[model samples]
Structure formats: structure tokens, C-alpha cells
Target: VEPYAALVLGPALLLALLGPRWWDRLLARRGKEHWDSYEALAADYLEALQGMPTLRATGAVGRVRERLERRSAALHRTTVAKLRVSLVDTGLTDLAVQGGTAAAVLVACSSAATGRTAATGTYLLLLLASECFRPVRDLSREWHAGYLGVSAADGITGLRTAEAAVPDRGTVAADWASAPEIRFEDVRFTHPGSGRPALDGVSFTAAAGRTTAVVGPSGAGKSTLLSLLLRQRDPDRGSLTVAGTATAAYTLASLRRGIAVVSQDTYLFHATIAENLRIARPAATDEQLRAAARTAGIDQEIARLPDGYATLVGERGATLSGGQRQRLALARALLADAPVLILDEATSAVDERGQARIVRELAAAGRGRTCVVVAHRLDAVRHADHIVVLDAGRVAATGDHTTLLAGGGVYASLVAAGRTAQEERAA
Candidate 1:
């Protein structure tokens, strides 16, 4: 056989070397887009599911279902296209492997017929030719398996990239045993793509072992202020400190561990009551859970349930009443035992008596910890040790209830409006 017959394997060797580069150009770009498309579709499905009740109320469920079907069909088409691209690459690889082996076999036969080698030599040549393509086949198989990971890795990176831009790292630890003063010094923040700053020149201190209430008009930046304190956001122009130490000095995990939050929208998964409470403190005992629930004014209600702590909350606590969900959130926060507690409209859904009990519980807890509140009702904050009134993203006034009421500014007007509303309701 001619030594030049070995030249037949040239194409296969070239493909083995260059195929990866080709795949990277086509497959990687498609992979990222594929993940993004799937994510968008999934988000739409979740939205549709969550709003199903509203859709039914408006007699729009069928229309929404039709839209979803259209999207599903589009997704099916996209999936088929991606599969075809993968198959094409695989087919090319198989073609090279087969063509090279066949050429080598034909040459070996020609050499044997010419008696250029004994039978043993021809058999050896055939065996050697088959094994030569094995490595390329192995690489092709590995590539097919690994392309799935490439697409999945993009989705994982996207989920994490939001907070990755700002690396919050520190070695300083928070003191869990003592309540720390949380002070915002001329803090300012503008949300991405927003035309106006959410909080501008806003400064206040939530003193240790005291209840501090933030009362504001609609859009007065109350929630944004608390988010800064929670270190969910970093202020653009100023510093926030806890216990005289800048919040950035403490590790993110430790800073968060020292604080607990109960937002207006309570989130409970589909699980037993006991399981949800344990999420706040995984090691909490049954007695501890009961105590926190009692303080949040929900223990008696649980006692009435047939399964008590074993009751399921359903999806996002949909099975329970709004008041019940809020109380459960409060109980979970209390169970966390953090030295600093943040409550945003914590009592808005509770009955009058339940609200009073929650207020009293906060007061009692204030002796050993700090409480920062974004109060829904102005009158509910009458007993707050300190009140910070915000207007137009700035501190309009700051004082205790009586002083601010007597001072006759924004806080006083808010109080008056609340009282007048109450009087109107009574009349």
C-alpha cells in the first residue's frame, strides 16, 4: 500500500481539532439564548398561575390559556431547532470517522491482494485502522453530554449575578446579645432606571433598646430606608452604622443575623406551621415556637385548629386569612431572636385587639432589643419612644409623639388626618 493513503484521515484529524471551535461559535451562543427564552416562558407561567383567581374573576382565564398555548408551541419549535443543530454536528463527526475507516480498509485490501503482506499483516492493518477513529468518537460522545451543562451554567450565573456586582465581605462580627444603635447618616439612594431618588438626605437613628417609628406620606421612602438598614442596598452618598460601626465593616451574614424583618407581604410556603417557624431558627424547640406565636398573638388561633402546628399554609399561605399570615410572619420574626427587629406594616391586617397585643409585645421586647417600625396607622405609633416623619424622601420632622403633635408640622397633620378618618368612620 502507498504511504500516501494515510492522507485520507487528514479531514477527520482536522475536524477533531477544529470542531470544538465551530461548536463554541454556534452552540454556546444558542445555548445562552435558549436558557433566556426558557426563563422568560417560565416566568410567564408563574405569573399566570399566581393570577389565576383574578383571571377567573375577570372571565379572562381562557384567553390567558390560549396565549400560553401559543407560547408553548413556539417553545416546542425552538426546542426542535436546537436539537437539529446538535444532530448536525454529531452527523458530521460520524461522517469523518466512517469515511477514514473505510478508506483505510480499502487500502489494506489492496495491499493484501497484491501479496505485499501476509494474511497476519493485513489483519493487523485492519484492526489498527478501526482503533484510530475510536478517540474521535469518544470526544464526540463527551461533547454531546457536556453541551447541556453549558446552557444550564448560564442560568445559574444569571441568578447569582444581581448581587455579585457588589461584593460584600468583612470579618467583623455583630453582637447578638446586645441591641445596637442603627443610624443612617445623610443616606441617599436612587433605584436603577428611576428618575427620582427614593431616599434623599434622609438621616435618622433607631436607638438601642427603644422603639422607633417611621411615619410618612405615600411615596415618602419608608421602605427604602429600612432596606438600607437591612443592608439589602448600599446607600449611594452616605453611611449607615450599627453600634457605631459602619454596616459594611461587619460581614453580610452576621449583619443580617442580628436583624429580623416582617414585611407587609407575608411569605409562607406550602408546609406545616411548625416547619415555617423553624425556618427562622432551625434549632427552635416546641416551647420556643409556642412562646413566639403567643407573643405575636396567634397561639390561641392555632390551638383552635384541628392539627394546630401541623396545619398546612397552602401556597404562599393562601389557605389562611391575611391576618393569620401576618401574625405567622411576626411569630417567625420573633422566633429569630435577632437584637434588631424591623416591622413594616406588621399589624395592618390584624384586628384591633390583636394589633394592640402586637404593639404591647413590641414594647415588652423593646427592653432587651431595638424595634424599628414603618407604621401603617399614625395613631398606632403614639407610644413609640421616637418618631421620624419623612416627607418627599427627606426627614420633615423628628420627635416623640406628643412633641411632634404639639410642634404642628407634617407629623402633626398626619396624626390629625388619621384621627379625622377614625372620627368619620365612627360617625
Candidate 2:
């Protein structure tokens, strides 16, 4: 008993001191994954906030709020449940160790009274027994922390499951010649959660070296057509071909490599201007970066910055104006140098002067590439060699701008609406 006391007391004290650290480490490791998941959710919410104006205008703010609330509640509930489990495990472990130590002391005292051991021996026995259980107590405490970590891991696993369900076409291919030509063969599409189709048997040949402009009203499926071309979503029925090959035959990577897109809602990483441009062409030289910026009419703004192209654009290019971001996106697409280009309302957010410059640049850029422009502005599509008008997800008309306007159908109405909207805004 005396010898045991000497062995147990020293090690027990040491373990008691070190035990909490192990627990803390386990908790930290487990919590890290959950923290990351929460961060991703935060980013999604932030992006939603950035589009608040649009959501409000479209009357989707309520739906957005509801979704946010639900997610937040779920996260909160998960955290609380994990905390409760950890607390219970830790509490039980502490109680068991303390209770066992108390009982051991009583037994040692009884042994000494009955002459089974001396008083000193009994005291030593009690101390030794308490010390022996110290490591077990430490282990119990660690288990609590481990459970906490496990809970965090569980949260992360759930988040990953959700992310997996989202459709993500992998990285685009880098080769150009191997790219496929895009074809819409009687393609029909209905948006997710929408009652009607956005495209109805839309057939078109968007071969290389020609520009095709889709002109239409607010909900005319112009954007949907471009989305299909980009392979963001597949058609509900009929096949889409690329370069004489079916889209389904090629990997998403190979299909997307054949095209580049610039939309009105341009997204920019929180990086330097040069870095942003380099995303389209990672190996591009500084000279090439400057050249692309100049072509996009954003060189002047970049020059004004203290770091020039190296200046950070902040989140989503919030530091820059809408026109600047649009131009930056244009520069990115140009630097990509894909065989096919898609400009979906690319100039909608730009001012009149910026729009004119983009139009001119696009015309020049469209000379030898297959360009598909979805424009709400009449002036943008007026010069297109071929114009396609869509109404209620169907091809309502197809011709040159002048011819379509003369036809005095849906196209004419859209043109009239544009003029009216412009005039009203001006007034």
C-alpha cells in the first residue's frame, strides 16, 4: 500500500494536470470541421445579402428570409445538442471518479481498524487507490471532449452531404481545338420549380466564327438559352450537340472548355485585378493582362489604383463600380480565348457610354468566334447578323433586327417596351 501510494500519487498529479489539455485538443479538432461548415453557410448568406436589391425587386425577399431562418435554426439546434451531450458525459465521469475515491477511503480505514494494516499503511492505501484512479478520471474527461469533437464532425458530414447534392460540373478543359461545336437540336427546357418550359424545341446551329444574338422580353427565356449553351442545366427533352458530337457523349469538362461566358451579374474573387484576370489565363504575362484590361476599357481605373492591376478588388469587386466589374468580367472572358462566347445581358449594368464601348469591342471580338449575346437593350442586338426572339420559352421570331421589328410581333413589342422603360426612367 505504501509503495503503491508513492507510485500512484506522482503519476496521478501529472495526469490530472495534462488531462484537460488532451480534452481541449480533441474538442478543437472536432470543432474545426463544424466551424468550416458554418463559415460556408455564412458565405452563402453574405452572397444572398449582396443580391438583396434584386430579391426585393423580384419579391423573393420573404422566401430568402425563410430559408435563412430555417438553416440558422438547424445549426443552432445541432450545436446545443452537441453541447448537452458533452456536458452529461463530463459530469458523469467526474461523479463516478469522486464517488469511487470516497468508497476506497472507507474500506482502507476499516482494514486498519481490524488490524489488517497499520494506520500509516491504511492512509497510504487510500492515497494510492485515489491516485490509481486518476488516469481513469483523466480518460473519462477526454472522452467527453472526444464526444464534442465527434459532434462537430457529424455537423460537417451533414453539410458535405448537402453540398454533394448540388450540381457541379467539374473544371473546364484547357484545349481549344479539341472543343466541340454547340448545337441545340429541338431542345426543350423547363426551369427547376417552374410550371412552364423556358425553351420549347429550340433548334439552332451555333458553329464557330459566327455571332448569334438572342433578343427577347423580360421573361422570354433568352437567359435560359444561354444557360443551356453553357451546360449549366440540361434540357428537359431533346438533345444538345457540340461540334457534331452529342453533349452527353463528352465530359462536362470538355464541353465547357469550348465556351466562355460573361453575364450581367459578374462575379469577382476578392483578389488583385491582375489575379482576377489571370483566372482566365493563369500563364498570361503582365503585358497580356494589361492588354486585356485595355480592351475592356478598364485600364484607366486600374491605372488610378495605387497598386495598379495588383490592387485587391475586395469581395465580389465591391470596391469597383458595376461598370468596372462588368468590364473586368469581359476582360476575363476575352483572356480565356474560348472558341465560343456567351454574353448574357453583359452590358445591362453598364452606363450608356460603357454599353457602346462594349458593343464595339464585342463586334470586333465576334469576328472569328461563335458569340451568343442575350440582350434586353435593342441597340446591342441591332447590329447582330442574326437575331432570335423568344417568348414564353419558345422561339417566337428569328431574323435581323430590322426585319424582326418590321414583322411587328413579339419582337416589336419588346422593342417598344424597352423604349418605354428607358423613357420612363429618364423622366
Local accuracy of candidate 2 as per-residue lDDT tens digits, 151-174 = 457567788776432155444343
Candidate 2: residue 149 lDDT (0-100): 58
lDDT of 1 by residue, 346-383 (tens): 98998777788788876786577898989869756889
Clashing pairs in 1: none
Model number with the top TM-score: 1
Candidate 2 regions off by >4 Å? Answer: 1-89, 115-124, 146-155, 159-174, 178-180, 424-427
Model 1 weakest 10-residue run by lDDT: 1-10
Task: Report lDDT (CA) for all predictions.
Answer: 0.85, 0.75
User: Total clashes, candidate 1?
Assistant: 0
How much is the lDDT of residue 421 in candidate 2? 86
How many pairs of residues collide in model 2?
2
RMSD of each: 3.1, 6.6
